[model samples]
Target: MSNDVKRPSGRHHGDLRRVLEEAALELVAEGGPKACTLAEVSRRAGVSVAAPYKHFADRDSLLAALVQKGYAEQRDRYVAAMKRKVEPAEQLAAFARAYVEFAAEQRPMFELTFAAGLDKTKYPELLNAGAELFEVLREPARNLRNTEAGSRDLVLAVAAAAHGLAVFVLEGVLLNVSQAKDLAASSARAIV
Candidate 1:
Protein backbone atom coordinates (compact mmCIF):
# COMPACT_ATOMS: atom_id res chain seq x y z
CA MET A 1 0.00 0.00 0.00
CA SER A 2 3.00 2.30 0.34
CA ASN A 3 3.36 4.14 -2.92
CA ASP A 4 6.95 4.97 -2.07
CA VAL A 5 8.05 1.33 -2.03
CA LYS A 6 9.72 0.57 -5.34
CA ARG A 7 8.38 -2.25 -7.51
CA PRO A 8 10.86 -4.86 -8.69
CA SER A 9 11.97 -4.23 -12.28
CA GLY A 10 11.91 -6.53 -15.34
CA ARG A 11 8.81 -8.54 -14.47
CA HIS A 12 6.65 -9.86 -17.30
CA HIS A 13 3.15 -11.26 -17.63
CA GLY A 14 2.27 -14.94 -16.94
CA ASP A 15 3.67 -17.00 -14.04
CA LEU A 16 2.65 -14.80 -11.17
CA ARG A 17 4.31 -17.24 -8.80
CA ARG A 18 7.67 -16.65 -10.40
CA VAL A 19 7.06 -12.91 -10.27
CA LEU A 20 6.31 -13.09 -6.57
CA GLU A 21 9.43 -15.18 -5.96
CA GLU A 22 11.62 -12.70 -7.80
CA ALA A 23 10.16 -9.83 -5.84
CA ALA A 24 10.76 -11.64 -2.57
CA LEU A 25 14.37 -12.37 -3.55
CA GLU A 26 14.93 -8.71 -4.37
CA LEU A 27 13.70 -7.77 -0.91
CA VAL A 28 15.89 -10.40 0.75
CA ALA A 29 18.89 -9.40 -1.35
CA GLU A 30 18.50 -5.78 -0.30
CA GLY A 31 17.95 -6.41 3.42
CA GLY A 32 18.17 -10.05 4.54
CA PRO A 33 15.27 -12.47 5.09
CA LYS A 34 13.59 -10.53 7.88
CA ALA A 35 12.99 -7.69 5.50
CA CYS A 36 10.91 -9.82 3.20
CA THR A 37 7.19 -9.71 3.93
CA LEU A 38 4.24 -10.95 1.92
CA ALA A 39 2.79 -7.47 1.74
CA GLU A 40 6.08 -6.01 0.64
CA VAL A 41 6.62 -8.77 -1.90
CA SER A 42 3.12 -8.34 -3.33
CA ARG A 43 3.52 -4.59 -3.44
CA ARG A 44 6.87 -4.86 -5.18
CA ALA A 45 5.45 -7.34 -7.67
CA GLY A 46 2.69 -4.84 -8.45
CA VAL A 47 0.02 -7.24 -7.21
CA SER A 48 -2.56 -6.67 -4.52
CA VAL A 49 -1.46 -7.68 -1.01
CA ALA A 50 -4.01 -10.50 -1.02
CA ALA A 51 -2.70 -11.88 -4.27
CA PRO A 52 0.34 -13.58 -2.76
CA TYR A 53 -1.90 -15.78 -0.66
CA LYS A 54 -2.79 -17.68 -3.80
CA HIS A 55 0.87 -18.59 -4.28
CA PHE A 56 2.17 -18.75 -0.69
CA ALA A 57 0.63 -19.32 2.71
CA ASP A 58 2.80 -16.68 4.43
CA ARG A 59 6.24 -15.13 4.64
CA ASP A 60 7.93 -18.32 5.88
CA SER A 61 6.66 -20.31 2.93
CA LEU A 62 7.94 -17.65 0.56
CA LEU A 63 11.31 -17.76 2.28
CA ALA A 64 11.36 -21.53 1.91
CA ALA A 65 10.72 -21.17 -1.80
CA LEU A 66 13.54 -18.65 -2.01
CA VAL A 67 15.87 -21.05 -0.24
CA GLN A 68 14.95 -23.82 -2.64
CA LYS A 69 15.55 -21.57 -5.65
CA GLY A 70 18.85 -20.40 -4.20
CA TYR A 71 20.12 -23.96 -3.85
CA ALA A 72 19.20 -24.74 -7.45
CA GLU A 73 20.99 -21.67 -8.74
CA GLN A 74 24.05 -22.36 -6.61
CA ARG A 75 24.16 -25.94 -7.92
CA ASP A 76 23.94 -24.67 -11.50
CA ARG A 77 26.87 -22.35 -10.92
CA TYR A 78 29.03 -25.16 -9.51
CA VAL A 79 28.07 -27.45 -12.37
CA ALA A 80 28.90 -24.76 -14.92
CA ALA A 81 32.22 -23.99 -13.25
CA MET A 82 33.15 -27.66 -13.27
CA LYS A 83 32.32 -27.93 -16.94
CA ARG A 84 34.91 -25.29 -17.83
CA LYS A 85 37.74 -27.59 -16.78
CA VAL A 86 38.58 -31.08 -18.07
CA GLU A 87 40.93 -32.48 -15.41
CA PRO A 88 39.52 -33.92 -12.19
CA ALA A 89 41.70 -31.82 -9.89
CA GLU A 90 40.88 -28.71 -11.87
CA GLN A 91 37.18 -29.51 -11.73
CA LEU A 92 37.34 -29.99 -7.98
CA ALA A 93 39.14 -26.70 -7.56
CA ALA A 94 36.58 -25.00 -9.77
CA PHE A 95 33.75 -26.29 -7.58
CA ALA A 96 35.50 -25.00 -4.47
CA ARG A 97 36.12 -21.58 -5.96
CA ALA A 98 32.60 -21.40 -7.30
CA TYR A 99 31.10 -22.32 -3.96
CA VAL A 100 33.12 -19.72 -2.08
CA GLU A 101 32.64 -17.01 -4.66
CA PHE A 102 28.87 -17.56 -4.74
CA ALA A 103 28.71 -17.05 -1.01
CA ALA A 104 30.71 -13.88 -1.35
CA GLU A 105 28.66 -12.48 -4.22
CA GLN A 106 25.22 -13.40 -2.93
CA ARG A 107 25.63 -12.62 0.75
CA PRO A 108 21.97 -12.14 1.60
CA MET A 109 20.74 -15.17 -0.30
CA PHE A 110 23.71 -17.11 1.01
CA GLU A 111 22.81 -16.25 4.58
CA LEU A 112 19.18 -17.13 4.04
CA THR A 113 20.11 -20.41 2.40
CA PHE A 114 21.71 -21.46 5.68
CA ALA A 115 19.30 -19.67 8.01
CA ALA A 116 18.34 -21.36 11.24
CA GLY A 117 14.94 -22.92 12.03
CA LEU A 118 14.50 -24.22 8.50
CA ASP A 119 12.14 -27.19 8.86
CA LYS A 120 13.08 -29.41 5.95
CA THR A 121 10.12 -31.70 6.59
CA LYS A 122 7.76 -28.86 5.80
CA TYR A 123 9.83 -27.99 2.75
CA PRO A 124 11.17 -31.16 1.18
CA GLU A 125 11.99 -29.29 -2.04
CA LEU A 126 14.46 -27.22 -0.05
CA LEU A 127 16.05 -30.39 1.31
CA ASN A 128 16.24 -32.08 -2.08
CA ALA A 129 17.60 -28.99 -3.84
CA GLY A 130 20.34 -28.57 -1.23
CA ALA A 131 21.28 -32.24 -1.47
CA GLU A 132 21.75 -31.91 -5.24
CA LEU A 133 24.55 -29.38 -4.78
CA PHE A 134 26.47 -31.81 -2.57
CA GLU A 135 25.91 -34.56 -5.15
CA VAL A 136 27.67 -32.44 -7.77
CA LEU A 137 30.73 -32.15 -5.53
CA ARG A 138 30.91 -35.93 -5.09
CA GLU A 139 31.69 -36.56 -8.75
CA PRO A 140 35.05 -34.81 -8.71
CA ALA A 141 35.65 -36.15 -5.23
CA ARG A 142 35.24 -39.74 -6.47
CA ASN A 143 37.94 -39.00 -9.02
CA LEU A 144 40.27 -37.75 -6.27
CA ARG A 145 40.00 -41.04 -4.33
CA ASN A 146 39.39 -44.64 -5.45
CA THR A 147 37.09 -46.21 -2.88
CA GLU A 148 33.56 -45.00 -2.22
CA ALA A 149 34.26 -44.39 1.47
CA GLY A 150 37.49 -42.57 0.72
CA SER A 151 35.88 -40.39 -1.96
CA ARG A 152 32.96 -39.52 0.34
CA ASP A 153 35.36 -38.58 3.11
CA LEU A 154 37.48 -36.50 0.75
CA VAL A 155 34.35 -34.75 -0.55
CA LEU A 156 33.25 -33.87 2.95
CA ALA A 157 36.69 -32.53 3.80
CA VAL A 158 36.91 -30.43 0.65
CA ALA A 159 33.38 -29.08 1.07
CA ALA A 160 34.09 -28.18 4.70
CA ALA A 161 37.25 -26.35 3.72
CA ALA A 162 35.52 -24.42 0.99
CA HIS A 163 32.60 -23.52 3.30
CA GLY A 164 35.03 -22.40 5.98
CA LEU A 165 36.81 -20.15 3.51
CA ALA A 166 33.52 -18.67 2.42
CA VAL A 167 32.46 -17.96 5.99
CA PHE A 168 35.85 -16.45 6.80
CA VAL A 169 35.79 -14.24 3.74
CA LEU A 170 32.20 -13.12 4.36
CA GLU A 171 33.03 -12.34 7.98
CA GLY A 172 36.03 -10.21 6.88
CA VAL A 173 38.61 -12.60 8.33
CA LEU A 174 40.39 -12.79 4.97
CA LEU A 175 40.16 -9.16 3.83
CA ASN A 176 43.86 -8.72 3.12
CA VAL A 177 43.96 -11.54 0.58
CA SER A 178 44.83 -10.27 -2.91
CA GLN A 179 42.56 -12.81 -4.62
CA ALA A 180 40.16 -15.27 -3.08
CA LYS A 181 40.19 -17.47 -6.16
CA ASP A 182 43.95 -17.92 -5.96
CA LEU A 183 43.81 -18.87 -2.30
CA ALA A 184 40.92 -21.27 -2.96
CA ALA A 185 42.83 -22.88 -5.81
CA SER A 186 45.96 -23.27 -3.71
CA SER A 187 44.05 -24.72 -0.77
CA ALA A 188 42.19 -27.16 -3.03
CA ARG A 189 45.45 -28.25 -4.69
CA ALA A 190 46.99 -29.00 -1.29
CA ILE A 191 44.16 -31.35 -0.52
CA VAL A 192 44.18 -33.16 -3.85
Candidate 2:
Protein backbone atom coordinates (compact mmCIF):
# COMPACT_ATOMS: atom_id res chain seq x y z
CA MET A 1 0.00 0.00 0.00
CA SER A 2 1.14 3.57 -0.67
CA ASN A 3 2.08 5.83 2.25
CA ASP A 4 -0.39 8.50 1.23
CA VAL A 5 -4.00 7.77 2.10
CA LYS A 6 -6.97 8.36 -0.18
CA ARG A 7 -9.71 10.69 1.08
CA PRO A 8 -13.35 9.60 0.73
CA SER A 9 -14.25 10.19 -2.89
CA GLY A 10 -17.70 11.77 -2.80
CA ARG A 11 -17.92 13.00 0.80
CA HIS A 12 -17.70 16.75 0.38
CA HIS A 13 -17.31 18.83 3.55
CA GLY A 14 -20.69 20.47 4.19
CA ASP A 15 -23.19 19.69 1.44
CA LEU A 16 -24.24 16.14 2.24
CA ARG A 17 -27.01 17.06 4.59
CA ARG A 18 -28.33 19.61 2.09
CA VAL A 19 -28.17 17.06 -0.70
CA LEU A 20 -30.08 14.59 1.44
CA GLU A 21 -32.64 17.21 2.34
CA GLU A 22 -33.19 18.12 -1.27
CA ALA A 23 -33.50 14.45 -2.24
CA ALA A 24 -36.04 13.84 0.49
CA LEU A 25 -38.01 16.92 -0.58
CA GLU A 26 -38.06 15.74 -4.18
CA LEU A 27 -39.29 12.34 -3.01
CA VAL A 28 -42.01 13.91 -0.89
CA ALA A 29 -43.05 16.19 -3.73
CA GLU A 30 -43.24 13.21 -6.07
CA GLY A 31 -45.13 10.74 -3.85
CA GLY A 32 -45.84 12.35 -0.45
CA PRO A 33 -44.13 11.53 2.83
CA LYS A 34 -44.33 7.77 2.41
CA ALA A 35 -42.02 7.97 -0.57
CA CYS A 36 -39.29 9.80 1.37
CA THR A 37 -37.31 6.91 2.76
CA LEU A 38 -33.74 7.37 3.90
CA ALA A 39 -32.63 4.62 1.59
CA GLU A 40 -34.31 6.23 -1.39
CA VAL A 41 -33.00 9.68 -0.46
CA SER A 42 -29.48 8.42 -0.12
CA ARG A 43 -29.76 6.61 -3.42
CA ARG A 44 -31.13 9.65 -5.11
CA ALA A 45 -28.40 11.81 -3.68
CA GLY A 46 -25.75 9.36 -4.85
CA VAL A 47 -24.63 8.59 -1.35
CA SER A 48 -24.42 5.34 0.55
CA VAL A 49 -27.41 3.84 2.39
CA ALA A 50 -26.00 5.00 5.73
CA ALA A 51 -25.53 8.62 4.67
CA PRO A 52 -28.85 10.01 5.81
CA TYR A 53 -28.44 8.48 9.24
CA LYS A 54 -25.50 10.78 9.78
CA HIS A 55 -27.74 13.81 9.21
CA PHE A 56 -31.17 12.59 10.37
CA ALA A 57 -32.09 9.66 12.60
CA ASP A 58 -35.00 8.48 10.47
CA ARG A 59 -37.70 9.48 8.04
CA ASP A 60 -39.74 11.48 10.55
CA SER A 61 -36.77 13.57 11.65
CA LEU A 62 -35.92 14.26 8.04
CA LEU A 63 -39.52 15.21 7.38
CA ALA A 64 -39.52 17.45 10.43
CA ALA A 65 -36.48 19.24 9.09
CA LEU A 66 -38.35 19.84 5.87
CA VAL A 67 -41.29 21.25 7.84
CA GLN A 68 -38.96 23.55 9.72
CA LYS A 69 -37.52 24.78 6.43
CA GLY A 70 -41.03 25.41 5.14
CA TYR A 71 -41.92 27.53 8.15
CA ALA A 72 -38.71 29.52 7.86
CA GLU A 73 -39.45 30.15 4.20
CA GLN A 74 -43.00 31.23 5.08
CA ARG A 75 -41.74 33.68 7.67
CA ASP A 76 -39.28 35.17 5.20
CA ARG A 77 -41.98 35.57 2.60
CA TYR A 78 -44.37 37.22 5.06
CA VAL A 79 -41.70 39.64 6.24
CA ALA A 80 -40.76 40.64 2.72
CA ALA A 81 -44.32 41.00 1.55
CA MET A 82 -45.44 43.02 4.54
CA LYS A 83 -42.39 45.31 4.40
CA ARG A 84 -43.49 46.83 1.11
CA LYS A 85 -46.80 48.10 2.49
CA VAL A 86 -47.10 51.18 4.72
CA GLU A 87 -50.62 50.98 6.18
CA PRO A 88 -51.51 48.42 8.83
CA ALA A 89 -54.38 47.01 6.80
CA GLU A 90 -52.20 46.71 3.74
CA GLN A 91 -49.58 44.91 5.81
CA LEU A 92 -52.19 42.48 7.07
CA ALA A 93 -53.40 41.90 3.55
CA ALA A 94 -49.81 41.41 2.42
CA PHE A 95 -49.27 38.86 5.16
CA ALA A 96 -52.35 37.02 4.01
CA ARG A 97 -51.09 37.14 0.42
CA ALA A 98 -47.70 35.75 1.44
CA TYR A 99 -49.29 32.92 3.38
CA VAL A 100 -51.35 31.91 0.38
CA GLU A 101 -48.34 32.33 -1.90
CA PHE A 102 -46.22 30.04 0.26
CA ALA A 103 -48.89 27.39 0.02
CA ALA A 104 -49.11 27.84 -3.71
CA GLU A 105 -45.35 27.64 -4.22
CA GLN A 106 -44.56 24.83 -1.82
CA ARG A 107 -47.81 22.91 -1.73
CA PRO A 108 -46.34 19.49 -1.05
CA MET A 109 -44.02 20.58 1.71
CA PHE A 110 -46.70 22.83 3.17
CA GLU A 111 -49.15 19.92 3.25
CA LEU A 112 -46.49 17.71 4.83
CA THR A 113 -45.88 20.30 7.53
CA PHE A 114 -49.56 20.13 8.49
CA ALA A 115 -49.91 16.39 8.09
CA ALA A 116 -51.89 14.85 10.96
CA GLY A 117 -49.58 11.86 11.34
CA LEU A 118 -46.45 14.00 11.85
CA ASP A 119 -46.93 14.36 15.66
CA LYS A 120 -45.33 17.79 16.10
CA THR A 121 -44.62 17.11 19.78
CA LYS A 122 -41.65 14.99 18.80
CA TYR A 123 -39.93 17.98 17.26
CA PRO A 124 -39.16 21.06 19.33
CA GLU A 125 -37.43 22.56 16.32
CA LEU A 126 -40.81 22.64 14.62
CA LEU A 127 -42.28 24.52 17.57
CA ASN A 128 -39.55 27.11 17.30
CA ALA A 129 -40.15 27.35 13.59
CA GLY A 130 -43.86 27.93 14.15
CA ALA A 131 -43.10 30.57 16.73
CA GLU A 132 -40.71 32.38 14.41
CA LEU A 133 -43.31 32.32 11.63
CA PHE A 134 -46.01 33.75 13.88
CA GLU A 135 -43.63 36.30 15.33
CA VAL A 136 -43.28 37.82 11.89
CA LEU A 137 -46.96 38.79 12.05
CA ARG A 138 -46.97 40.07 15.62
CA GLU A 139 -46.13 43.73 14.97
CA PRO A 140 -48.60 43.88 12.11
CA ALA A 141 -51.30 42.22 14.17
CA ARG A 142 -50.71 44.60 17.04
CA ASN A 143 -50.72 47.57 14.71
CA LEU A 144 -53.97 46.42 13.20
CA ARG A 145 -55.48 46.04 16.67
CA ASN A 146 -55.07 49.77 17.26
CA THR A 147 -56.24 50.75 13.79
CA GLU A 148 -59.78 51.28 12.43
CA ALA A 149 -61.65 48.03 13.29
CA GLY A 150 -60.65 44.63 14.70
CA SER A 151 -61.79 42.31 17.42
CA ARG A 152 -59.54 40.69 20.01
CA ASP A 153 -59.99 37.46 18.09
CA LEU A 154 -59.56 39.01 14.68
CA VAL A 155 -55.94 37.97 14.29
CA LEU A 156 -56.75 34.39 15.23
CA ALA A 157 -59.70 34.37 12.87
CA VAL A 158 -57.60 35.73 10.03
CA ALA A 159 -54.94 33.05 10.55
CA ALA A 160 -57.57 30.34 10.58
CA ALA A 161 -59.14 31.71 7.41
CA ALA A 162 -55.82 31.92 5.63
CA HIS A 163 -54.95 28.34 6.49
CA GLY A 164 -58.34 27.11 5.37
CA LEU A 165 -58.11 29.04 2.13
CA ALA A 166 -54.62 27.73 1.48
CA VAL A 167 -55.87 24.20 1.92
CA PHE A 168 -58.72 24.87 -0.44
CA VAL A 169 -56.34 26.31 -3.02
CA LEU A 170 -54.04 23.31 -2.82
CA GLU A 171 -57.00 20.97 -3.22
CA GLY A 172 -58.06 22.68 -6.47
CA VAL A 173 -61.30 24.19 -5.20
CA LEU A 174 -59.88 27.73 -5.34
CA LEU A 175 -58.81 27.16 -8.99
CA ASN A 176 -56.12 29.87 -9.26
CA VAL A 177 -53.46 31.58 -7.15
CA SER A 178 -54.80 35.01 -8.08
CA GLN A 179 -58.24 34.10 -6.81
CA ALA A 180 -56.84 32.38 -3.72
CA LYS A 181 -54.66 35.34 -2.80
CA ASP A 182 -57.60 37.68 -3.33
CA LEU A 183 -59.85 35.53 -1.17
CA ALA A 184 -57.29 35.27 1.61
CA ALA A 185 -56.59 38.99 1.58
CA SER A 186 -60.27 39.92 1.46
CA SER A 187 -61.11 37.45 4.20
CA ALA A 188 -58.34 38.89 6.38
CA ARG A 189 -59.36 42.48 5.66
CA ALA A 190 -63.00 41.65 6.36
CA ILE A 191 -61.98 40.04 9.65
CA VAL A 192 -59.92 43.02 10.72
Candidate 3:
Protein backbone atom coordinates (compact mmCIF):
# COMPACT_ATOMS: atom_id res chain seq x y z
CA MET A 1 0.00 0.00 0.00
CA SER A 2 2.98 2.27 -0.37
CA ASN A 3 2.42 5.17 -2.71
CA ASP A 4 6.11 5.66 -3.28
CA VAL A 5 6.95 6.27 -6.93
CA LYS A 6 10.28 5.30 -8.43
CA ARG A 7 12.88 8.05 -8.72
CA PRO A 8 15.78 8.26 -11.15
CA SER A 9 19.36 7.86 -9.92
CA GLY A 10 22.37 10.22 -9.74
CA ARG A 11 20.87 12.65 -7.29
CA HIS A 12 22.69 15.73 -6.02
CA HIS A 13 21.81 18.13 -3.21
CA GLY A 14 19.07 19.73 -5.29
CA ASP A 15 17.87 16.32 -6.40
CA LEU A 16 17.70 15.07 -2.83
CA ARG A 17 15.66 18.11 -1.83
CA ARG A 18 13.32 17.46 -4.73
CA VAL A 19 13.12 13.78 -3.81
CA LEU A 20 11.98 14.68 -0.32
CA GLU A 21 9.41 17.07 -1.75
CA GLU A 22 8.18 14.47 -4.22
CA ALA A 23 7.88 11.83 -1.53
CA ALA A 24 5.96 14.18 0.71
CA LEU A 25 3.76 15.23 -2.19
CA GLU A 26 2.94 11.61 -3.02
CA LEU A 27 2.01 10.85 0.56
CA VAL A 28 -0.20 13.94 0.74
CA ALA A 29 -1.89 13.01 -2.52
CA GLU A 30 -2.62 9.46 -1.32
CA GLY A 31 -3.74 10.45 2.13
CA GLY A 32 -4.04 13.94 3.65
CA PRO A 33 -1.60 16.20 5.47
CA LYS A 34 -1.32 13.68 8.27
CA ALA A 35 0.13 11.16 5.86
CA CYS A 36 3.26 13.28 5.39
CA THR A 37 5.67 12.34 8.16
CA LEU A 38 9.44 12.69 8.33
CA ALA A 39 9.88 8.92 8.80
CA GLU A 40 7.41 8.08 6.06
CA VAL A 41 9.02 10.50 3.62
CA SER A 42 12.47 9.18 4.54
CA ARG A 43 11.31 5.62 3.89
CA ARG A 44 9.83 6.54 0.53
CA ALA A 45 12.84 8.64 -0.37
CA GLY A 46 15.20 5.70 0.34
CA VAL A 47 17.03 7.73 2.96
CA SER A 48 17.72 7.02 6.57
CA VAL A 49 15.00 8.17 8.97
CA ALA A 50 17.55 10.51 10.45
CA ALA A 51 18.42 11.82 7.04
CA PRO A 52 15.47 14.18 6.66
CA TYR A 53 16.54 16.01 9.80
CA LYS A 54 19.72 16.87 8.00
CA HIS A 55 17.64 18.64 5.36
CA PHE A 56 14.66 19.56 7.51
CA ALA A 57 14.78 20.39 11.19
CA ASP A 58 11.39 18.76 11.85
CA ARG A 59 8.01 17.95 10.30
CA ASP A 60 6.98 21.60 10.41
CA SER A 61 10.22 22.60 8.79
CA LEU A 62 9.66 20.11 6.01
CA LEU A 63 6.13 21.35 5.53
CA ALA A 64 7.42 24.91 5.48
CA ALA A 65 9.92 24.05 2.78
CA LEU A 66 7.21 22.34 0.74
CA VAL A 67 4.93 25.35 1.08
CA GLN A 68 7.67 27.74 0.03
CA LYS A 69 8.65 25.57 -2.92
CA GLY A 70 5.05 25.18 -4.02
CA TYR A 71 4.45 28.92 -3.86
CA ALA A 72 7.61 29.60 -5.82
CA GLU A 73 6.60 27.16 -8.54
CA GLN A 74 3.12 28.58 -8.71
CA ARG A 75 4.45 32.10 -8.84
CA ASP A 76 6.74 31.24 -11.72
CA ARG A 77 3.90 29.68 -13.65
CA TYR A 78 1.65 32.65 -13.01
CA VAL A 79 4.30 35.06 -14.23
CA ALA A 80 4.91 33.01 -17.34
CA ALA A 81 1.23 32.68 -18.06
CA MET A 82 0.80 36.44 -18.00
CA LYS A 83 3.45 37.16 -20.58
CA ARG A 84 0.96 37.69 -23.43
CA LYS A 85 -0.59 41.09 -24.07
CA VAL A 86 -4.26 40.33 -24.04
CA GLU A 87 -7.28 42.35 -22.99
CA PRO A 88 -7.31 43.06 -19.30
CA ALA A 89 -10.39 40.89 -18.91
CA GLU A 90 -8.85 38.05 -20.88
CA GLN A 91 -5.63 38.41 -18.93
CA LEU A 92 -7.50 37.99 -15.70
CA ALA A 93 -9.35 35.01 -17.12
CA ALA A 94 -6.10 33.38 -18.17
CA PHE A 95 -4.66 34.02 -14.75
CA ALA A 96 -7.62 32.36 -13.09
CA ARG A 97 -7.41 29.40 -15.42
CA ALA A 98 -3.72 29.08 -14.68
CA TYR A 99 -4.36 29.17 -10.95
CA VAL A 100 -6.85 26.32 -11.12
CA GLU A 101 -4.57 24.38 -13.44
CA PHE A 102 -1.70 24.68 -10.99
CA ALA A 103 -3.99 23.61 -8.17
CA ALA A 104 -5.22 20.60 -10.09
CA GLU A 105 -1.73 19.58 -11.08
CA GLN A 106 -0.18 20.16 -7.68
CA ARG A 107 -3.06 19.40 -5.35
CA PRO A 108 -1.00 17.91 -2.53
CA MET A 109 1.54 20.71 -2.55
CA PHE A 110 -1.17 23.29 -3.00
CA GLU A 111 -3.01 21.97 0.02
CA LEU A 112 0.07 22.07 2.16
CA THR A 113 0.96 25.51 0.90
CA PHE A 114 -2.42 26.97 1.77
CA ALA A 115 -3.28 24.90 4.80
CA ALA A 116 -4.19 26.89 7.94
CA GLY A 117 -2.67 26.60 11.43
CA LEU A 118 0.85 27.31 10.21
CA ASP A 119 2.40 30.37 11.88
CA LYS A 120 3.22 32.70 9.04
CA THR A 121 4.90 35.03 11.51
CA LYS A 122 7.38 32.32 12.37
CA TYR A 123 8.06 31.68 8.67
CA PRO A 124 8.67 35.11 7.19
CA GLU A 125 10.37 33.79 4.09
CA LEU A 126 7.47 31.51 3.22
CA LEU A 127 5.03 34.30 3.98
CA ASN A 128 6.89 36.68 1.68
CA ALA A 129 7.04 34.12 -1.10
CA GLY A 130 3.35 33.35 -0.78
CA ALA A 131 2.57 37.06 -0.78
CA GLU A 132 4.65 37.57 -3.91
CA LEU A 133 2.65 34.87 -5.70
CA PHE A 134 -0.58 36.69 -4.87
CA GLU A 135 1.02 39.91 -6.04
CA VAL A 136 1.10 38.54 -9.59
CA LEU A 137 -2.64 38.99 -9.70
CA ARG A 138 -2.30 42.66 -8.87
CA GLU A 139 -1.86 43.67 -12.48
CA PRO A 140 -5.20 42.30 -13.60
CA ALA A 141 -6.67 43.33 -10.28
CA ARG A 142 -5.49 46.90 -10.69
CA ASN A 143 -8.20 47.40 -13.27
CA LEU A 144 -10.79 46.71 -10.59
CA ARG A 145 -9.06 48.69 -7.87
CA ASN A 146 -10.09 52.16 -9.10
CA THR A 147 -13.78 51.40 -8.79
CA GLU A 148 -13.23 49.72 -5.44
CA ALA A 149 -10.84 50.89 -2.76
CA GLY A 150 -10.61 47.39 -1.33
CA SER A 151 -7.77 46.13 -3.46
CA ARG A 152 -6.71 43.67 -0.83
CA ASP A 153 -10.25 42.37 -0.54
CA LEU A 154 -10.56 42.07 -4.30
CA VAL A 155 -7.35 40.10 -4.58
CA LEU A 156 -8.36 37.80 -1.75
CA ALA A 157 -11.79 37.34 -3.30
CA VAL A 158 -10.38 36.36 -6.67
CA ALA A 159 -7.88 33.97 -5.05
CA ALA A 160 -10.54 32.42 -2.83
CA ALA A 161 -12.82 32.00 -5.81
CA ALA A 162 -10.08 30.32 -7.82
CA HIS A 163 -9.16 28.05 -4.92
CA GLY A 164 -12.79 27.13 -4.31
CA LEU A 165 -13.32 26.48 -7.98
CA ALA A 166 -10.27 24.24 -8.06
CA VAL A 167 -11.44 22.30 -5.02
CA PHE A 168 -14.86 21.87 -6.56
CA VAL A 169 -13.44 20.67 -9.84
CA LEU A 170 -11.07 18.26 -8.11
CA GLU A 171 -13.81 17.01 -5.81
CA GLY A 172 -15.96 16.03 -8.82
CA VAL A 173 -18.41 18.89 -8.54
CA LEU A 174 -17.33 19.98 -11.98
CA LEU A 175 -17.44 17.00 -14.31
CA ASN A 176 -15.26 18.45 -17.06
CA VAL A 177 -11.94 20.24 -16.92
CA SER A 178 -12.89 22.41 -19.86
CA GLN A 179 -16.10 23.33 -18.12
CA ALA A 180 -14.20 24.15 -14.99
CA LYS A 181 -11.87 26.35 -16.96
CA ASP A 182 -14.78 28.16 -18.52
CA LEU A 183 -16.39 28.62 -15.13
CA ALA A 184 -13.18 29.98 -13.66
CA ALA A 185 -12.75 32.37 -16.56
CA SER A 186 -16.29 33.61 -16.25
CA SER A 187 -15.97 33.89 -12.49
CA ALA A 188 -12.81 35.93 -12.80
CA ARG A 189 -14.50 38.27 -15.22
CA ALA A 190 -17.42 38.74 -12.88
CA ILE A 191 -15.42 39.08 -9.69
CA VAL A 192 -12.52 41.14 -10.97
The estimated TM-scores of all candidates read 0.81, 0.84, 0.85
Question: Which residue pairs collide in model 2, if any?
Answer: none
CA lDDT, candidate 1, residue 154: 76
| Candidate 1 residue-wise lDDT at 148 | 85
Ranked candidates (TM-score, high to low): 3, 2, 1
> By TM-score, how accurate is candidate 2?
0.84
lDDT of 2 by residue, 87-175 (tens): 87778788888888888899777877787257777988888888777666767777767642443356667788888989888888888
lDDT of each: 0.80, 0.80, 0.78
Worst 10 residues of 3 by lDDT: 5-14
Task: Write the residue-wise lDDT of candidate 3 on 1-192 in tens digits.
Answer: 466864457333557777887888889899867788889998888877887877888888888888888888888887777677367666777877888888788888778877624688989998799778767777677766774446667777777877788889778888677777778878978986
Show where candidate 1 strays beyond 4 Å: 1-15, 176-178
Clashes of each: 0, 0, 0
Q: Candidate 3 regions off by >4 Å?
A: 1-14
Report the CA-based lDDT of candidate 1 relative to the real structure: 0.80
Q: Return the lDDT, model 3, position 107.
A: 84
